[model samples]
Target: MSQDTQPAYRRILLKLSGEALLGEHHYGVDPAVLSQVAEEVCELSRRGVEVGIVIGGGNIFRGAGLAEGGVDRVTGDHMGMLATVINALALQDAIERAGRFCRVMSAIRINQVCEDYIRRRAVRHLEKGRVVVFAAGTGNPFFTTDSAASLRAIEINADLMIKATKVDGVYDADPFTQTDARRFDRLTYDDALERRLGVMDTTALVMCRDNELPIRVMNMFAKGDLQRLVMGESVGTLVEGSRQ
Candidate 1:
């Protein structure tokens, strides 16, 4: 379908899981997952959707777990940051392989591998019609990538933030384990906060809510779900202040 035919946002931030990049593997990165993500992202670009991306490092390193085991928080955070950088490089290769121009910008200066993250430079790249992949988890410790996604969304003035998760949508309980869990077609930030929904981190949720930013949570594993989410169609769950 032509992009003009069905796109809800002129610009969006795609928050992808590192595990999604690993496909079905027990561990490590998977080429198939990378290719699949590239296909979907390229489809969005084809439909005229400007895309910015934030990648998670869970599949690579869950440093918080290490910190719990007695490692210094800063060291653990550095490991997580490096993991995100690896995901960023993989995403850059996949996006470019799909024939869409993309730039990988890291919070840390890895001049030989990718460009360093500079707000002005990132904006310029986007304005120039290039997809920008943001990595390295805010370049600090004790902060999750979810927060980074929110900060980048606001920094780049994104229309919406599409969180590509493992579930079809958000539920009152874990859908996988709970048989009676129901999915909401839409929700408000207040409700999410009041109920302590696990859909997003409290800090990230508060940032988006305060800014009146809309967030869509959808299953990346489901076929066409991510694309549909980007187009503002019924996909997974839509959490917002109101419908436009």
Candidate 2:
């Protein structure tokens, strides 16, 4: 596709796992991986696809993991949120270095470093062709970043939500362990929920369903996966509400 071509989804919310930034490392962000991700986003922006990104904190920290280690759940979650901010900053820097403008907006106030997320401001950024990165996971302790991605996508009027992960798509069982695992190319929101498929958290899935927002879960490590998805090529598991 031409770099000037219009994307299938005019605007999209990208959900990235913090662990994906780790690459082959045991933990934390890997510079090579982060740079590639930034390059992908930059390429999409160059193609006129308005993109908003939300990244998780699993690489640096996990609130649930800390809670299991005897830390306070709320405190652990707060730390996790801060971890996301760090990743957001790194990504913002990478995008900017790639000659694209990017804004880091945090749910929690970090005024000196980035702007506080305001719905109007974020929409305006997209209108002006600036990539917006959302951090801090809803600014609430209990919620996951997946829910934050859904909430922000709806607020920004995104055409679709994309969950970028290590796996290519959602399957009936864990593909790594289950040799016969079946991957679904398409699924009704209700069926995904009824089957207890972990496409995303139940809350995030419900939010998308209620809003009628479609989601594509695809593997980020796969070459050209994001580009293909934006160009309307089928490369991931699609989830949406069933129409009457």
**Model 1, total clashes:** 1
Off by over 4 Å in 2: none
Best by TM-score: 2
RMSD of each: 1.6, 1.0
The global C-alpha lDDT for each of the candidates, from Candidate 1 onward, is 0.86, 0.94
Cα lDDT tens digits, model 1, 1-244, are 4456778788898888777777778777899888888888888887778889999898888779789999988999889889998988888888898999999888878889989999989988887778899999788887888889999998899999989988888899988898999988788988888898787888888899989788999888787877767666788887888544
lDDT of 2: 0.94
Error of 2 at 21 (Å): 0.4
Score candidate 1 by lDDT: 0.86
Rate residue 31 of model 1 by lDDT.
Answer: 90
lDDT (Cα, 0-100) at 180 in candidate 2: 99
